[model samples]
Target: MQLSEQCVLITGGARGLGHHLSLAFAREGAQVIINYHRSAQAAQALAAQLGPRQAIALQADVTDPAQVQAMLATAAGHFGRPLTTVVNNALAAFSFNGDARPKADAIGWDAFQSQFEGSVRGALNTVQAALPAMRAQRFGRVINIGTNLFQNPVVPYHDYTAAKAALLSLTRTLAGDLGPDGITVNMLSGGLLRSTDASAATPEAVFDYIAANTPLRSVTTPAEFADAALFFASPWARAVTGQNLVVDGGLVRD
Candidate 1:
């Protein structure tokens, strides 16, 4: 779908990387629905900043299937049309502070389970809730947020990466199942973002190390990744689905 033709809903879009995505979509004249679980005030402020004509904020916990369904209904009602694109950008509680993370041996099933709930299950709920509308229109763009840690585990982020690995699998398989309906599912993975609520705790040295090792010799900003996200949902990507686009400045080849 063209950016201007899109009624976009970005889960967890009130702040961090989602905030950038929301802004980017609004800049292209798309109506944006900013979903927030706990950041209602921030979400409302952003929607106001983006202007009522292009943005609105709604509260929904992506982990809850019922909430997701209701949120989708509210967004479509607000726009007076079914949503054309759904950005599965919501994240379970996590931080980019590797220093405080549990080691491989110290981790347990509960740790992995939580990540799965946030990464995989939450995505499933959003996708299923949005699918009927998409199928009716035969046009939808599902952009999932992922991480490069699964491709190259430079850090010992076992639980988070494993959950994302599962999500990647869903992206491909769902692509095959949904292609005929004109809905495309793709993943946008990035390494440690230079700055975000999740990555704000990243050590400065880690950022320097990644930049020096990357071909671009720089850390990719949330805005930069947000721009690339636009492509996956745009007409240019109509032929693309079940693919992973890594935007970590060439840190991960895939």
Candidate 2:
């Protein structure tokens, strides 16, 4: 689908990278549905700033199919068009402070389960809820957000990385199943993004070290990574699916 033809529903679109993505897509003429679980004010403000015609804020717990369906219906009502693209960019409630994370021995299965509920299960709900409309249109784009930690576990965010790795698996499998329907599924993996709320707790030296090691000699920014996400939904990438694009400036080769 082309940018102008899309009604993009971005999960967790209230802040951080998702917020930037909402602005990026709207700037390119896509009618955006900004979905937020709790940041109602931020989401509404963003939609208002983008103007009522181009965007609207929706509330939903992406992990719940019922809420997702309601949210989708409300979004479609606002736009009078089925959503053509979906971005699963919601992170499990987590901070980037590695020192504060549970040690490997202390981490339990529940830790992994919690992350999966927010990341993997949340994506599953949104994708399934959006599938009917997408299949009916014979055109859809499902972009899942991932982290480069899977490739180079720099700080070893085990639970987060494991859940994302699972998401990547689903992305590939679903791509094959939905390929005939023209719905492309792909993952965009970014490194520690520069100064998002999640990354705000990260130590400065950590950022400096990653910057020195990366090919770009600087950590990636949210907007820069979000633009790569836009490409996945564009006609330019119609031939692409089930692939993970690392937006970490050559920090890790896939």
Candidate 3:
């Protein structure tokens, strides 16, 4: 098992893409810690199925540094020491609704700041809370979830795209800063994933168009996206850091 005896913490793991990532890590023999803010029932059910020893779900608002610290402490207690991987998969409340597509003039500072708090602040809190343990073990993997839209800018989800761009910057800087400690930071950006709760509001015609235009002539599923994330967390990617791996069926060429 590539991740045997390793401990991984995934935020927003109660459902959608995060749920699949948690399962993928657990299947690779990792002791998974899932953090949820409002989906307690779903998180507990997932943990129960994975077995108490292999999976544990805790509640925490990643935007709150105090809550994030407490969640990390609880995870350490449940899974022993030396947190090996941290996946900052949490998203802001603004991302849930489909109405977030506001023109540049319509979008205000509050909207941008809210998204930043959820994407950037959440990752910072998780990294800060887990860095000490990683440094002690001299190994760590920090994978931030990002979007390919920022590169293509087809839909222009201004606030959301801007936030992910900032996260990419953080990923590179953190990789440089933490490299000496054997910690790697990277970003995984995927085109609109199919069959996720977040994409429920997206029009069927739009999805079909993307599928038709993509090189693979198919849509990317949450499970497929999880595979890319697993690579970043695995030993094979030891030399990979501060990079963005876009898994979008080669939709947008940089």
Candidate 4:
């Protein structure tokens, strides 16, 4: 019950990692606001299951500043409390098939820009939109979902990895700026989550390689990563900010 009476907003909360995080937050007694771009049915279904008093869903494309603002307004109106935590977990619908991988020389500006728009710009929009309320309440936790691939780079997800790295940079800078307002900003990076839709196309060999190489000799699950997120939002981490926690079974020790 570390998050009791807290309000949290999670982008892309309809499915996959986001979906699990939303449910985890609700179980901790948080009033959860889940944001979905295209998974309207999934969002509604999740909200219903979590119970109306603890969970609500909003539709917004995080890449658009206007949409983000509207979504925040809607959440505030419905919950009667400004968001205490914001999770920037949305990503563009890009397949990461091996053959589809773009080499540095082959990647066009559009390809790189699209990833940045969804990951970096989306985080910025959420941070900016929630700052006023956070400052007023003197408490905030901004957790950006990152990727351990940015550190190891064993597999070159050029555009996606770069975008996540940019988000990490933003998280640190925001932590410095918002520290005085009692806000903590942190990033949680995980390596090759076991059961997320994002990893559906990842080869079995790749999974086996990670499992064998990681310190724990296994892959991390979405629930485990979500628990790390919850810790950042908890009072235990009040003094912990501008940091990145790698929940990758100690695979890439940075």
Instruction: Work out the TM-score per prediction.
Output: 0.98, 0.98, 0.96, 0.97
TM-score of candidate 1 versus the correct structure, residues matched by position: 0.98
> Candidate 4, residue 160: CA error in Å?
0.5
What are the per-residue Cα lDDT tens digits for candidate 1 across 47-160?
A: 999887788899988899999999989888888888889898888888888898899779888989999998899889998998888999999999999999887997888899
lDDT of 2 by residue, 53-88 (tens): 999999999999999999999988888999899999
Q: After superposition, how far is residue 188 of candidate 3 from its true place, in Å?
A: 0.3
Question: What are the Cα lDDT values of the candidates?
Answer: 0.91, 0.93, 0.89, 0.90
Q: C-alpha displacement of 67 in model 3, angstroms?
A: 1.2
Model 1 stretches astray by more than 4 angstroms = none
lDDT of 3 at 202: 81
Tens digits of per-residue lDDT for model 4, 1-254: 15987999999998999998998899889999999999999999999999878889899999999999999999888888788889999988766455568887788888789999999999999999999999898999999999888779877688888899999999999999999999999999988888788888888888888899988999898898888899999989989999999999999987
Q: Please give the distance, in angstroms, between residue 233's alpha carbon in candidate 4 and its true position after superposition.
A: 0.1
Candidate 3, residues 93-114, lDDT tens digits: the string is 6443345577877878898898
| Stretches > 4 Å off in candidate 2 | none
Residue 209 Cα positional deviation in candidate 1, in Å, after optimal superposition:
0.6
In the order shown, the candidates' Cα RMSDs to the true structure are 0.9, 0.8, 1.5, 1.2
Q: Could you say which candidate leads in TM-score?
A: 2
Q: Pick out the ten consecutive residues of candidate 2 with the lowest summed lDDT.
A: 148-157
**Candidate 4, 161: how far from true, in Å?**
0.8
